[model samples]
Target: MTLALLPRYDEPRLLTAQMELIDQSFGIAMLGCSLAAMILASGLAITGGHPGALPWAATMVVACAIAHFGRLAVPDRLTEARSGRYARAMTAMLVLIGSLWGLVAWLYLDIRSPAVVICVLSLIAGMSAAALAVFSACLPVAVGFFVPAIVPVWIVFLATGDIAYLPMFLGTPLYLVVLMIFARNYARVARHAIALRFENLELISQLRDQTARAGQAQRQAEEANRAKSVFLASASHDLRQPLHALGLFVVSLSRTTLDAHQRQLLTHIEASSGAAREMLNTLLDFSKLEAGVVTPRPRPFRLQPLLHKLENEFAPQANARGLVYRTRDTTATLFGDPSLVELILRNLIANAIRYTRAGGVLVACRPRRFHVSVEVWDTGIGIPTAQHRDIFREFHQLGNPERDQRKGLGLGLAIVEGLARTMQTRVTLASTPDRGSVFRLRLPLAWTAPEEAADPQIAMRLDGLRVLVIDDDAAIREAMAGLLAIWNCPCRTAENEDEALALLDDFPPDLILADYRLRGHRTGHEAIAAIRSRVGRRLPAIIITGDTAADRLRNAHADGTALLHKPVVPGELHAAISTLMRESEWSRAEQ
Candidate 1:
């Protein structure tokens, strides 16, 4: 019945932990019990001088030694299968030891000496207290030892039926009850402590798992970003190659003698090509901004020239659409990346020209004491107040549901916002329906040296000047050669470095033009470097590429080589080649 009252654990791990705790302290408990037994037996032998007492002392000592040694012989690591059996065996051994102690109490009670009876009762009480402390981790084991040790002694006192023994007989049961209560309370405390320890361990395990999962997710996101960059790089290059060739072909065709109708057709072709190039550029700009590769190079420059450039570029478009175009110039010297500022202004003006079907557009700069605000006001179908915020989002256009490519890819304003952020500034917008919209870009004012005059336009004549062109694509090579031939420049072409070097040995050209990415995983820079080494002279060179990857753009900028993006404008290409040739000529003359 006492065993039934002992605490029962539902968790297998908790039960195993209790058994382990018992096993760890088993030796200490046995040693203490053995010492106590020896002391009691010695006292009994001296006072009672009973012959049976001596034999009983020897039996108790042997029993304790057997129990202790038997525990030591069990395996160090208890498996689940053996843990229950081991616990039961420990309980049985403790009970046996307790019974042996009880025998001492029963036998000594017959001696009829007051001193011997006191000693017997004291020993039984001490043994019960020791059992409570030792076996508390496993409550059933404590109960098994405690009941056997005390019940026998209490029964003996009751049988005596004397008045002196009556107080003890009545008191013994109450005393037993108090000890049982202490054992049960201690058992609960031990169970709670073990439970808390396991709970902490489980929490730590879960935390470690969550940390690992987060790290894995972070790595996967980084990998996906890298893959996206690679795909965009490949696609940009592949798509631009044909566009570059076609632009060159059109330039070559325009040089031929043609009727007025044919000339008008060429103009239309150029317009379509120009529109396609703008869309492609917008896409590339968006990609670069998303990849965080656009850096601003700011300098103090006059706003008049930049505003005038915008006016010149858009005035014709505005007139063609029968909308008024005007500009108010200020001599305000603003500090910023001039090219980026121009990009923002260009997009704003372009959007205005595209959206305004009736009213004119105004481009103006207002100077303040500390800053200048460049504003673009359009009298087009004004933006709704609800969509004023959404207008800046990528690929979002108002009133162009058919997704017209001519109105642009809806990325112009997005690029404008991104560029403003790069410049550490914000773009302001104001609009009312059926009225107009205004975009104001504010910039800090700066004082600087007077601006230098633009470089004088050099003669585009390339007659008798030998030029080398190297490209992997056959069409690009042929188109480039034909275009250069139209300028009366003698040209040589190659498919790779080896072919270029072979061409150089026979006809060393005055200028070298190469594609950035070449076959066999070679770069145009390497080819240029090799040719310069072979020639023993630093030759003027240019790197033309269609790659819009952020890293590639950064590398190209760092290389200090003259670069042109693919589908290059005929006028721009001619200008770049002419400028490099002039610089080369100046350097040679100085030598």
Candidate 2:
């Protein structure tokens, strides 16, 4: 009966909790009330002169004794498995007790003394109210007690035609009905609360599982990214080796005598190699930027020469493309790395030209109170407002659906942004779709103008320069020797550090061009250290390498050597050596 009254939710825990609540119902307070009621009712029966009161009282004492022991034993048996049997036994007990109390109430109606009858009635009412408190949780159990007990009291009042007992008969049944309703509501609340608790627990468990999966996925993604980085570095190094040697050989061949037909073929070859070199150099620039090897040297510098240099470099391309590449001159002296600023402007201009098919590109500078804004304007396919931020991201391009290598790898603007960030400046873009976009670079203002570098003579004397080329590759060595011969500069080539050191006695190199990675786990830096130590002179040196690894690049250029990556341009190579010779310790101290 007790089990039937509990709400069924198909959850084992809910049923178990209900049984536990029912178990708590059989405790000291409940048993004491029953025993006290039995005693007080028996006393009233005897006071009203009823002879049957003695036996009834004795029966009640026995029932109360049995209930006391049952209450003590209830907790041990109060499990779901035992709940059914336990509930039936409890119902039978309630019937017996309720019948005894009803008999006591009936016995009171026969008492002639009004005061004794009143006392008996009071006891019956109190006992029934107590049963309502104790048994009302289960409606079946309440019904068992009330049917036997309340019906008899009602029958006696009606049969005897007693006006005094009418109120008791009417009000007692109503009171029991109210208690059943209250108990029903209480059980509903308990059931809902239990269901809610389990639901919350299930949700928490799912959340934890999702969190674990997400963490694992993140770890896997990070590992894949690292693997990608390693592959790119390795591939870049290998590809640069051959291209570097090929570029050197091409430049060396260009200097030799050739017929007009052969010269044109050579020109085509130069163009092809130059395109490849440009792509590779772009990759190298991105790698250096990623490795944080590119640092800006900000100083007060005139902006006109930089603009002129860019104009000269891009003007030919603009003329070939039939696009007007105009630069409005500004005497504004900006404070920033001229080389970095040039690279930024170079990319922006190149991008402007590439995107602008029929229209022209403009470069101008605007002076402000504390800074100068260098703007690159173009009349090409403009950008959408939504993609302004995305354009700066590496490899994100617009309108180049074919992924043309000529337009670049989409890293030009990324590199520009990186250089700008390194120089502590910003690049902003404003555009409308189908129209040209303008990219503006803000640079700090300079109070004093920097000294201009003297323009390189059409021919710089390399007559007295004795060069030593240290490389493990035979082709690179031969190419360097051939290229140096074209410059009328005597040179010696070595396959290893030992061979190079041995040649020092006869060759006594005035300049060292050493490949970074050499045979015997040796590096050009180490070879140069040994060479300087042996000759007791700080020779002008350059560490030419094909390494694109971030950590290696950082360590390679740490000592401030004139480091150049593989596939070096003959013009740039010549200029680097010239600059080194002019400013080296040997030139400054000895010359």
Q: Please name the candidate that would achieve the greatest TM-score relative to the true structure.
A: 1
lDDT of 1 at 572: 86
Give the per-residue lDDT digits (tens) of candidate 2, residues 7-87: 333244555555455556655434664666667656655665566777777787778668657756767555667666665
TM-score of 2: 0.76
Clashes of 1: 0
Q: What lDDT does candidate 2 reach at residue 220?
A: 90
**Which ranges in model 2 have alpha carbons more than 4 Å from their true place?**
1-9, 13-173, 452-468, 488-510, 518-522, 526-540, 586-591
User: What's the TM-score of each model vs. the native?
Assistant: 0.81, 0.76
